[model samples]
Target: MRMNAKDEAEMEYFGSTIRLQNENVTLRDTVQALNAALSARDDELANIEDELSDRENEVTRCERALELRVAQFNQEAEELVQQKEDHRRLKLECKKLQNQNKIE
Candidate 1:
Protein backbone atom coordinates (compact mmCIF):
# COMPACT_ATOMS: atom_id res chain seq x y z
CA MET A 1 0.00 0.00 0.00
CA ARG A 2 1.39 3.42 -0.95
CA MET A 3 0.78 6.58 1.15
CA ASN A 4 -0.94 9.51 -0.66
CA ALA A 5 0.73 12.98 -0.72
CA LYS A 6 -1.77 14.27 1.82
CA ASP A 7 -0.99 11.42 4.25
CA GLU A 8 2.78 12.04 3.88
CA ALA A 9 2.36 15.72 4.68
CA GLU A 10 0.23 14.91 7.70
CA MET A 11 2.84 12.43 8.99
CA GLU A 12 5.64 15.00 8.62
CA TYR A 13 3.67 17.61 10.50
CA PHE A 14 2.93 15.20 13.36
CA GLY A 15 6.61 14.26 13.71
CA SER A 16 7.67 17.91 13.78
CA THR A 17 5.11 18.68 16.47
CA ILE A 18 6.36 15.79 18.65
CA ARG A 19 9.95 16.92 18.31
CA LEU A 20 9.06 20.48 19.27
CA GLN A 21 7.16 19.26 22.34
CA ASN A 22 10.16 17.24 23.50
CA GLU A 23 12.48 20.21 23.05
CA ASN A 24 10.12 22.46 24.96
CA VAL A 25 10.01 20.03 27.90
CA THR A 26 13.83 19.84 27.95
CA LEU A 27 14.14 23.66 27.93
CA ARG A 28 11.66 23.98 30.79
CA ASP A 29 13.55 21.47 32.93
CA THR A 30 16.84 23.31 32.30
CA VAL A 31 15.28 26.64 33.23
CA GLN A 32 13.87 25.21 36.48
CA ALA A 33 17.27 23.73 37.48
CA LEU A 34 19.02 27.04 36.85
CA ASN A 35 16.47 28.93 38.91
CA ALA A 36 16.90 26.55 41.84
CA ALA A 37 20.69 26.95 41.75
CA LEU A 38 20.39 30.72 41.68
CA SER A 39 18.03 30.71 44.64
CA ALA A 40 20.41 28.55 46.70
CA ARG A 41 23.31 30.84 45.98
CA ASP A 42 21.30 33.86 46.99
CA ASP A 43 20.43 32.27 50.32
CA GLU A 44 24.08 31.40 50.95
CA LEU A 45 25.15 34.95 50.23
CA ALA A 46 22.62 36.29 52.71
CA ASN A 47 23.88 33.98 55.44
CA ILE A 48 27.46 35.04 54.85
CA GLU A 49 26.51 38.68 55.04
CA ASP A 50 24.72 38.11 58.34
CA GLU A 51 27.76 36.41 59.81
CA LEU A 52 29.99 39.25 58.73
CA SER A 53 27.72 41.79 60.36
CA ASP A 54 27.69 39.85 63.62
CA ARG A 55 31.47 39.64 63.69
CA GLU A 56 31.74 43.37 63.13
CA ASN A 57 29.46 44.04 66.06
CA GLU A 58 31.52 41.76 68.28
CA VAL A 59 34.70 43.55 67.27
CA THR A 60 33.18 46.89 68.11
CA ARG A 61 32.15 45.66 71.56
CA CYS A 62 35.63 44.28 72.26
CA GLU A 63 37.24 47.54 71.21
CA ARG A 64 35.06 49.51 73.58
CA ALA A 65 35.85 47.18 76.45
CA LEU A 66 39.58 47.50 75.79
CA GLU A 67 39.33 51.28 75.81
CA LEU A 68 37.64 51.24 79.19
CA ARG A 69 40.33 48.96 80.63
CA VAL A 70 43.06 51.24 79.35
CA ALA A 71 41.43 54.26 80.94
CA GLN A 72 41.14 52.46 84.27
CA PHE A 73 44.81 51.49 84.20
CA ASN A 74 45.85 55.06 83.48
CA GLN A 75 43.84 56.35 86.42
CA GLU A 76 45.41 53.76 88.75
CA ALA A 77 48.91 54.69 87.55
CA GLU A 78 48.30 58.37 88.26
CA GLU A 79 47.07 57.60 91.78
CA LEU A 80 50.18 55.51 92.46
CA VAL A 81 52.44 58.40 91.42
CA GLN A 82 50.58 60.79 93.70
CA GLN A 83 50.92 58.40 96.64
CA LYS A 84 54.69 58.06 96.07
CA GLU A 85 55.12 61.82 96.01
CA ASP A 86 53.18 62.18 99.28
CA HIS A 87 55.35 59.53 100.96
CA ARG A 88 58.59 61.31 99.92
CA ARG A 89 57.41 64.66 101.29
CA LEU A 90 56.50 63.10 104.66
CA LYS A 91 59.98 61.51 104.93
CA LEU A 92 61.68 64.86 104.33
CA GLU A 93 59.58 66.61 106.95
CA CYS A 94 60.30 63.93 109.60
CA LYS A 95 64.09 64.23 108.96
CA LYS A 96 64.02 68.00 109.34
CA LEU A 97 62.19 67.70 112.72
CA GLN A 98 64.78 65.20 114.02
CA ASN A 99 67.68 67.48 113.09
CA GLN A 100 66.09 70.46 114.77
CA ASN A 101 65.50 68.49 117.99
CA LYS A 102 69.15 67.33 118.08
CA ILE A 103 70.45 70.92 117.63
CA GLU A 104 68.24 72.21 120.48
Candidate 2:
Protein backbone atom coordinates (compact mmCIF):
# COMPACT_ATOMS: atom_id res chain seq x y z
CA MET A 1 0.00 0.00 0.00
CA ARG A 2 1.31 3.51 -0.89
CA MET A 3 1.61 6.13 1.86
CA ASN A 4 -0.20 9.50 1.77
CA ALA A 5 1.64 12.84 1.43
CA LYS A 6 1.39 13.52 5.19
CA ASP A 7 3.11 10.25 6.16
CA GLU A 8 5.88 10.83 3.63
CA ALA A 9 6.51 14.35 4.95
CA GLU A 10 6.76 13.08 8.55
CA MET A 11 9.25 10.38 7.52
CA GLU A 12 11.48 12.96 5.78
CA TYR A 13 11.42 15.20 8.88
CA PHE A 14 12.43 12.30 11.13
CA GLY A 15 15.37 11.39 8.92
CA SER A 16 16.64 14.99 8.87
CA THR A 17 16.44 15.22 12.67
CA ILE A 18 18.49 12.02 13.10
CA ARG A 19 21.19 13.34 10.76
CA LEU A 20 21.44 16.59 12.70
CA GLN A 21 21.82 14.74 15.96
CA ASN A 22 24.61 12.58 14.53
CA GLU A 23 26.44 15.65 13.22
CA ASN A 24 26.16 17.31 16.65
CA VAL A 25 27.69 14.29 18.36
CA THR A 26 30.59 14.17 15.85
CA LEU A 27 31.36 17.85 16.39
CA ARG A 28 31.37 17.45 20.18
CA ASP A 29 33.81 14.53 19.97
CA THR A 30 36.15 16.49 17.70
CA VAL A 31 36.21 19.41 20.10
CA GLN A 32 37.10 17.12 23.03
CA ALA A 33 40.00 15.51 21.10
CA LEU A 34 41.46 18.88 20.15
CA ASN A 35 41.37 20.04 23.77
CA ALA A 36 43.22 16.93 24.96
CA ALA A 37 45.94 17.39 22.33
CA LEU A 38 46.41 21.00 23.30
CA SER A 39 46.80 20.06 26.98
CA ALA A 40 49.49 17.47 26.17
CA ARG A 41 51.44 19.95 24.09
CA ASP A 42 51.38 22.48 26.89
CA ASP A 43 52.83 19.92 29.28
CA GLU A 44 55.65 19.14 26.85
CA LEU A 45 56.46 22.80 26.49
CA ALA A 46 56.77 23.22 30.23
CA ASN A 47 59.20 20.31 30.46
CA ILE A 48 61.36 21.75 27.69
CA GLU A 49 61.53 25.08 29.46
CA ASP A 50 62.80 23.39 32.61
CA GLU A 51 65.53 21.60 30.66
CA LEU A 52 66.66 24.84 29.10
CA SER A 53 67.01 26.50 32.47
CA ASP A 54 69.13 23.63 33.75
CA ARG A 55 71.49 23.87 30.78
CA GLU A 56 71.91 27.57 31.31
CA ASN A 57 72.93 27.00 34.92
CA GLU A 58 75.51 24.42 33.86
CA VAL A 59 77.03 26.80 31.34
CA THR A 60 77.40 29.48 33.95
CA ARG A 61 79.23 27.09 36.25
CA CYS A 62 81.63 26.05 33.49
CA GLU A 63 82.42 29.65 32.63
CA ARG A 64 83.32 30.47 36.22
CA ALA A 65 85.63 27.46 36.45
CA LEU A 66 87.38 28.45 33.23
CA GLU A 67 87.99 31.97 34.54
CA LEU A 68 89.57 30.61 37.73
CA ARG A 69 91.90 28.30 35.78
CA VAL A 70 93.04 31.17 33.58
CA ALA A 71 93.93 33.23 36.60
CA GLN A 72 96.00 30.40 38.12
CA PHE A 73 97.98 29.93 34.90
CA ASN A 74 98.77 33.65 34.71
CA GLN A 75 100.14 33.64 38.26
CA GLU A 76 102.33 30.60 37.54
CA ALA A 77 103.73 32.24 34.40
CA GLU A 78 104.74 35.36 36.29
CA GLU A 79 106.61 33.34 38.92
CA LEU A 80 108.57 31.47 36.26
CA VAL A 81 109.73 34.74 34.63
CA GLN A 82 110.94 36.12 37.98
CA GLN A 83 112.92 32.93 38.73
CA LYS A 84 114.71 33.20 35.36
CA GLU A 85 115.70 36.79 36.03
CA ASP A 86 117.17 35.89 39.46
CA HIS A 87 119.23 33.01 37.95
CA ARG A 88 120.78 35.31 35.32
CA ARG A 89 121.84 37.89 37.94
CA LEU A 90 123.51 35.21 40.12
CA LYS A 91 125.49 33.83 37.14
CA LEU A 92 126.84 37.28 36.24
CA GLU A 93 128.05 37.91 39.82
CA CYS A 94 129.87 34.53 39.92
CA LYS A 95 131.68 35.28 36.61
CA LYS A 96 132.94 38.68 37.85
CA LEU A 97 134.41 37.14 41.04
CA GLN A 98 136.21 34.43 39.05
CA ASN A 99 137.83 36.99 36.73
CA GLN A 100 139.10 39.09 39.66
CA ASN A 101 140.67 36.02 41.34
CA LYS A 102 142.48 35.07 38.14
CA ILE A 103 144.04 38.59 37.75
CA GLU A 104 145.33 38.56 41.32
Candidate 3:
Protein backbone atom coordinates (compact mmCIF):
# COMPACT_ATOMS: atom_id res chain seq x y z
CA MET A 1 0.00 0.00 0.00
CA ARG A 2 1.30 3.37 -1.13
CA MET A 3 0.77 6.52 0.93
CA ASN A 4 -0.41 9.45 -1.23
CA ALA A 5 1.32 12.81 -0.96
CA LYS A 6 -1.38 14.25 1.37
CA ASP A 7 -1.28 11.20 3.63
CA GLU A 8 2.54 11.34 3.80
CA ALA A 9 2.39 15.01 4.72
CA GLU A 10 -0.15 14.36 7.47
CA MET A 11 1.95 11.50 8.87
CA GLU A 12 5.05 13.67 8.99
CA TYR A 13 3.17 16.43 10.78
CA PHE A 14 1.88 13.99 13.43
CA GLY A 15 5.34 12.55 13.89
CA SER A 16 6.79 15.97 14.43
CA THR A 17 4.06 16.81 16.94
CA ILE A 18 4.73 13.63 18.91
CA ARG A 19 8.48 14.36 18.98
CA LEU A 20 7.86 17.87 20.21
CA GLN A 21 5.55 16.58 22.95
CA ASN A 22 8.17 14.07 24.12
CA GLU A 23 10.79 16.77 24.23
CA ASN A 24 8.49 18.99 26.29
CA VAL A 25 7.89 16.19 28.79
CA THR A 26 11.61 15.53 29.12
CA LEU A 27 12.30 19.20 29.72
CA ARG A 28 9.60 19.36 32.38
CA ASP A 29 11.03 16.35 34.20
CA THR A 30 14.52 17.90 34.14
CA VAL A 31 13.19 21.13 35.62
CA GLN A 32 11.45 19.25 38.42
CA ALA A 33 14.61 17.29 39.27
CA LEU A 34 16.66 20.51 39.41
CA ASN A 35 14.14 22.12 41.73
CA ALA A 36 14.25 19.14 44.10
CA ALA A 37 18.04 19.24 44.18
CA LEU A 38 18.02 22.95 44.95
CA SER A 39 15.57 22.43 47.81
CA ALA A 40 17.75 19.73 49.34
CA ARG A 41 20.85 21.92 49.18
CA ASP A 42 18.98 24.76 50.84
CA ASP A 43 18.00 22.51 53.70
CA GLU A 44 21.58 21.31 54.11
CA LEU A 45 22.87 24.85 54.19
CA ALA A 46 20.39 25.75 56.90
CA ASN A 47 21.53 22.85 59.04
CA ILE A 48 25.17 23.79 58.67
CA GLU A 49 24.42 27.36 59.65
CA ASP A 50 22.62 26.17 62.76
CA GLU A 51 25.57 24.03 63.77
CA LEU A 52 27.93 26.94 63.33
CA SER A 53 25.75 29.13 65.50
CA ASP A 54 25.75 26.50 68.25
CA ARG A 55 29.52 26.31 68.21
CA GLU A 56 29.81 30.06 68.45
CA ASN A 57 27.59 30.10 71.51
CA GLU A 58 29.63 27.39 73.18
CA VAL A 59 32.85 29.28 72.58
CA THR A 60 31.38 32.38 74.16
CA ARG A 61 30.40 30.44 77.28
CA CYS A 62 33.87 28.95 77.61
CA GLU A 63 35.52 32.35 77.28
CA ARG A 64 33.36 33.80 80.02
CA ALA A 65 34.12 30.89 82.33
CA LEU A 66 37.86 31.27 81.76
CA GLU A 67 37.69 34.95 82.52
CA LEU A 68 36.00 34.28 85.85
CA ARG A 69 38.59 31.68 86.81
CA VAL A 70 41.45 34.07 85.98
CA ALA A 71 39.87 36.74 88.17
CA GLN A 72 39.56 34.32 91.09
CA PHE A 73 43.21 33.28 90.74
CA ASN A 74 44.36 36.89 90.82
CA GLN A 75 42.44 37.56 94.01
CA GLU A 76 43.98 34.49 95.74
CA ALA A 77 47.50 35.53 94.73
CA GLU A 78 47.03 38.98 96.23
CA GLU A 79 45.84 37.47 99.52
CA LEU A 80 48.91 35.23 99.67
CA VAL A 81 51.26 38.20 99.23
CA GLN A 82 49.60 40.15 102.05
CA GLN A 83 49.80 37.17 104.42
CA LYS A 84 53.54 36.77 103.76
CA GLU A 85 54.20 40.42 104.49
CA ASP A 86 52.32 40.18 107.82
CA HIS A 87 54.29 37.08 108.82
CA ARG A 88 57.64 38.81 108.15
CA ARG A 89 56.73 41.84 110.37
CA LEU A 90 55.62 39.54 113.21
CA LYS A 91 58.96 37.68 113.12
CA LEU A 92 61.00 40.92 113.34
CA GLU A 93 59.05 42.10 116.38
CA CYS A 94 59.58 38.77 118.16
CA LYS A 95 63.35 38.91 117.60
CA LYS A 96 63.64 42.45 119.08
CA LEU A 97 61.76 41.44 122.25
CA GLN A 98 64.03 38.43 122.73
CA ASN A 99 67.19 40.61 122.53
CA GLN A 100 65.90 43.20 125.05
CA ASN A 101 65.01 40.47 127.57
CA LYS A 102 68.52 39.02 127.35
CA ILE A 103 70.13 42.45 128.10
CA GLU A 104 67.89 42.96 131.13
Candidate 4:
Protein backbone atom coordinates (compact mmCIF):
# COMPACT_ATOMS: atom_id res chain seq x y z
CA MET A 1 0.00 0.00 0.00
CA ARG A 2 1.36 3.45 -0.99
CA MET A 3 1.56 5.91 1.92
CA ASN A 4 0.24 9.48 1.67
CA ALA A 5 2.51 12.52 1.66
CA LYS A 6 2.12 13.14 5.41
CA ASP A 7 3.57 9.75 6.40
CA GLU A 8 6.47 10.06 3.96
CA ALA A 9 7.33 13.53 5.28
CA GLU A 10 7.56 12.26 8.91
CA MET A 11 9.90 9.39 7.88
CA GLU A 12 12.16 11.83 6.01
CA TYR A 13 12.44 14.07 9.09
CA PHE A 14 13.58 11.17 11.32
CA GLY A 15 16.14 10.10 8.74
CA SER A 16 17.65 13.61 8.67
CA THR A 17 17.86 13.68 12.50
CA ILE A 18 19.78 10.37 12.56
CA ARG A 19 22.26 11.66 9.99
CA LEU A 20 22.89 14.80 12.09
CA GLN A 21 23.60 12.65 15.20
CA ASN A 22 26.12 10.55 13.29
CA GLU A 23 27.89 13.67 12.07
CA ASN A 24 28.16 15.02 15.61
CA VAL A 25 29.65 11.71 16.85
CA THR A 26 32.26 11.71 14.05
CA LEU A 27 33.25 15.32 14.88
CA ARG A 28 33.67 14.48 18.58
CA ASP A 29 35.93 11.52 17.83
CA THR A 30 38.13 13.61 15.51
CA VAL A 31 38.56 16.26 18.22
CA GLN A 32 39.63 13.61 20.79
CA ALA A 33 42.28 12.20 18.38
CA LEU A 34 43.68 15.72 17.79
CA ASN A 35 43.97 16.30 21.55
CA ALA A 36 45.92 13.05 22.01
CA ALA A 37 48.40 14.00 19.27
CA LEU A 38 48.92 17.44 20.80
CA SER A 39 49.67 15.88 24.19
CA ALA A 40 52.34 13.63 22.65
CA ARG A 41 53.98 16.61 20.96
CA ASP A 42 54.09 18.53 24.23
CA ASP A 43 55.83 15.61 25.97
CA GLU A 44 58.49 15.47 23.27
CA LEU A 45 59.18 19.19 23.66
CA ALA A 46 59.68 18.78 27.40
CA ASN A 47 62.19 15.97 26.87
CA ILE A 48 64.22 18.12 24.51
CA GLU A 49 64.31 20.95 27.03
CA ASP A 50 65.60 18.59 29.72
CA GLU A 51 68.40 17.39 27.46
CA LEU A 52 69.48 20.95 26.73
CA SER A 53 69.67 21.80 30.43
CA ASP A 54 71.88 18.77 31.09
CA ARG A 55 74.29 19.76 28.35
CA GLU A 56 74.55 23.31 29.67
CA ASN A 57 75.44 22.05 33.16
CA GLU A 58 78.14 19.78 31.77
CA VAL A 59 79.69 22.66 29.86
CA THR A 60 79.87 24.75 33.01
CA ARG A 61 81.70 21.98 34.87
CA CYS A 62 84.23 21.54 32.06
CA GLU A 63 85.00 25.27 31.99
CA ARG A 64 85.75 25.31 35.72
CA ALA A 65 88.10 22.34 35.36
CA LEU A 66 90.00 24.07 32.56
CA GLU A 67 90.48 27.20 34.71
CA LEU A 68 91.99 25.15 37.55
CA ARG A 69 94.44 23.49 35.16
CA VAL A 70 95.57 26.86 33.79
CA ALA A 71 96.17 28.27 37.29
CA GLN A 72 98.30 25.28 38.26
CA PHE A 73 100.42 25.65 35.13
CA ASN A 74 101.02 29.35 35.92
CA GLN A 75 102.18 28.50 39.48
CA GLU A 76 104.67 25.85 38.21
CA ALA A 77 106.06 28.31 35.63
CA GLU A 78 106.67 30.95 38.33
CA GLU A 79 108.58 28.41 40.49
CA LEU A 80 110.84 27.43 37.58
CA VAL A 81 111.73 31.12 36.94
CA GLN A 82 112.69 31.63 40.62
CA GLN A 83 114.92 28.57 40.55
CA LYS A 84 116.78 29.86 37.45
CA GLU A 85 117.51 33.25 39.12
CA ASP A 86 118.91 31.54 42.24
CA HIS A 87 121.33 29.49 40.07
CA ARG A 88 122.64 32.67 38.34
CA ARG A 89 123.52 34.37 41.71
CA LEU A 90 125.32 31.27 42.97
CA LYS A 91 127.53 31.13 39.83
CA LEU A 92 128.65 34.82 40.31
CA GLU A 93 129.59 34.28 43.98
CA CYS A 94 131.75 31.21 43.10
CA LYS A 95 133.76 33.28 40.57
CA LYS A 96 134.45 36.07 43.13
CA LEU A 97 135.78 33.51 45.70
CA GLN A 98 138.21 32.06 43.12
CA ASN A 99 139.73 35.57 42.37
CA GLN A 100 140.16 36.31 46.10
CA ASN A 101 142.02 33.00 46.64
CA LYS A 102 144.46 33.77 43.77
CA ILE A 103 145.40 37.15 45.34
CA GLU A 104 146.12 35.54 48.73
User: Could you report the Cα RMSD, in angstroms, for every candidate shown?
Assistant: 2.0, 2.5, 1.9, 2.6
| C-alpha lDDT of candidate 4 relative to the true structure | 0.93
Residues 12-89, model 1: lDDT tens digits: 999999999999999999999999999999999999999999999999999999999999999999999999999999
Tens-place lDDT digits, model 2, residues 1-104: 99999999999999999999999999999999999999999999999999999999999999999999999999999999999999999899999999999999
Clashing pairs in 3: none
- Choose 2 or 3, whichever is better by TM-score: 3
Candidate 3 Cα deviation (angstroms), residue 31: 1.4
Compute the lDDT of residue 86 as modeled in candidate 2: 90
Best by lDDT: 1
**Could you tell me every candidate's TM-score relative to the true structure?**
0.80, 0.74, 0.82, 0.73
The 10-residue segment of model 2 with minimum total lDDT is 81-90
Instruction: Give all candidates' CA lDDT scores.
Output: 0.99, 0.95, 0.98, 0.93
TM-score of candidate 3 versus the correct structure, residues matched by position? 0.82
Cand. 2 TM to true fold:
0.74
Clashing pairs in 1: none
lDDT-superior candidate, 3 or 4:
3
Clashing pairs in 4: none
lDDT of each residue in 2-101, candidate 3, tens digit only? 9999999999999999999999999999999999999999999999999999999999999999999999999999999999999999899999999999
Compute the lDDT for candidate 2. Answer: 0.95
Q: In angstroms, how far off is 104's CA in candidate 1?
A: 2.9
Residue 60 lDDT, candidate 1, scale 0-100: 100
